[model samples]
Target: MATRRDPITWFDALNVVLLTMVAAACVIPMIHVTALSFSSEGAILSGRVSLLPVGFQLQGYRTVLESAAMMRALGFTVYLTILGTSVNVMITALGAYPLAKPDLVGRRLIWLLILFTMFFSGGLIPIFMVVRALGLLDTVWALILPGMIATFNLILMKTYFSGIPTSLAESARMDGASEIGILMRIILPLSTPIIATLTLFYGVGHWNQFFLALIYIQDPDKYTLQLRLQQLITDGIGYGPTVVFGQADDIPVESVKAGAIMFATAPVLIAFPFLQRHFVKGALIGSLKE
Candidate 1:
């Protein structure tokens, strides 16, 4: 039987107040940015806009969307996110499944070696040289391949896979199911929560890839959205050089920057909800034992 709970105490009230403030701290900046994006040039420049738009306008969004470079960057980012996330999920799952098997020989050494990578790397120069040697420079593969299998995600996946009942795997083997068959038909079906969670993780990582593109991709056409936005922010003073008006001096750089941020951020925010239902469960289960 369930026990009766005591009524909320002063401590509970204090906790609520503290949590609400923290929530506001996070959400308020986004609200301000959204409001700034819609606010008129004069209102933004005058520093009058706050949580709400003053003298609403769509100029910042219009400028960002109208640029051919921005459009190309958006398209490239979408492609990179989709392709990179797919590769990450596939490779991580494949690698993790084998590692999760208790009977697998030399698993500890393999795990240790992989874990070592998380703490140390050969540095940027060596990585760049390797990418250059592979002829991946200035290519989409340059963005997707270098850091494909994140060690953290791999560890999480292996932990998740290990939690599945060993009996289920044994039963499949007894029924003559191949290892691949067991993974595809048995393990994966039971692994939806972790899969969805990791997909979201990988998707967001690829969507936000900037430094990789900045280093390896020289062609303007291959610039990811974040990298292009950085260029716009630096070169255009946030508002493009061509933004025409008598009140041109009144235009706020913050508004243009916010609009660009929103443009780059929208897809991830939208994609998040589909995977959110599984995120908490996945994180808890994966982290608890390993």
Candidate 2:
């Protein structure tokens, strides 16, 4: 027997139309930027480029790639992302696991204290002073250590861990498994979805890290990719003076900026696909309470 389906209403149609417009608003600019990046200087300057390149060329990318400063910034950003995300996930998980245990003494008080930090903080100057006092200024640790365990990510992880059946942990404990052993061998393996979700969250944060780097890192050589892109866009600094001087005709300032934007954005776009399958499920599950 065929079941009768509800007929589409005006609200449903309106929602579809609005969502499509929103999606296009987000996507069209990216397409235009990509087109600008690939199009010839003449095409871009004449406004001939839109969603598609008018005269395809790779000179902009070539200029960006040939620069030593941009390459160093890219390497440093990659290193920061990897190291920061690893520490973030590990520390968040370890903290969440213990809090998830119902038998843990003072769990509620500990949770309340942690939760208090979300609404209140020591402000920028105090944090900067503490970092400076600790001799973390002008060092990578200044960026990583200050904002290590995000309160929101920790809460979400704890909620996810709480949703897991207690029987699993009990079974591991009966076999004389330690807390660390249970977390590593049983809980973490089963929490892959949330782990992957948080990994993406923390990874993107680290990748797009700019203000922190700007504040802590005074050395131009240690600039992150975003900072380098900012320099390119604002100062018309095309990689270096030599590249700019030689390729000025082939790669215009606007084209270089577009290419640099794409370069900074590409890694996150590439990595998101691998984690997309788990992202929605993990986010939804973690946000739910038992």
TM-score between candidate 1 and the true structure:
0.90
The C-alpha TM-scores of every prediction are 0.90, 0.91
Range of the 10 consecutive residues with the lowest summed lDDT in candidate 2:
240-249
Please give, for residues 1-290, the per-residue lDDT of candidate 2 as tens digits: 22458676797889889999999999899899999999888889888898998789888888789877889889998899999999999999999999999989999899999989999989999999999999988777887999899988898888889888999999999999999999999999989888998999899998999899988898876888887777677654555433333445544677777898898899877887898987788777755653
Highest-lDDT candidate: 2
Mark the regions of model 2 whose C-alpha exceeds 4 Å error after superposition.
1-5, 9-14, 235-251
| Candidate 2, residue 217: lDDT | 92
Full-model lDDT for every candidate: 0.83, 0.85
The C-alpha local distance difference test score for the whole of candidate 2 amounts to 0.85
